[model samples]
Target: MYLSQVKSNGKQYIYLCVYVGTQEYSTRKEKRVYSFGETKKALIKMKRWKRKFNEFPNELLNLGCGMENLEEWIRTIETGITKTGRIFKTNVKRAVF
Candidate 1:
């Protein structure tokens, strides 16, 4: 189910305070929502969300790999999901796709 989704910087992020699953999913267990953005920007947004809910956003994301769906699809090329609960910016090329 979708709720008050953020339209910031062409990415949609769901927050605990603004998300409430639909009726079909009676139980609103805010879980992995997908989003996209630069690492710094995403973390800033996450920090804001944590400030409001006192909790972290356990989101499922493409890690901001290039947006494509071919054999080189950005979404499909990422290594895997990470659950880091802190903000970090890196100059390492390997870290970013």
Candidate 2:
């Protein structure tokens, strides 16, 4: 997602755009755009959206350390044990892959 500013007849407008999908080079890409009246309101909405979606799950970070198997990750979380014997008080959630 991104923001775009437009000027028309000396008036400024803000737009919030999301990239929805892609297509072949010969076809147009899919996107969604929302208009937010002015700079102040647009900025506030942008901040809220950022706070809502910018969070990364900690379990996802663990994937880099050889926890590529979902079942193993689930067991580790349930038993709260690691190779170093450290207990992780993790609140796991259903995450999309």
* RMSD (Å) per prediction: 13.3, 17.5
* Cα lDDT of model 1 by residue, 1-97, tens digit: 2212344575444322235456474675454345434434544544444345433333422333221211121211122222222222232123331
Positional deviation of 87 in candidate 1, in angstroms? 14
RMSD of 2: 17.5
**What is the lDDT of every predicted structure here?**
0.33, 0.43
| The 10-residue segment with the lowest total lDDT in model 2 | 61-70
lDDT of candidate 2 at residue 34, scale 0 to 100 = 53
Clash count of each predicted structure? 0, 0
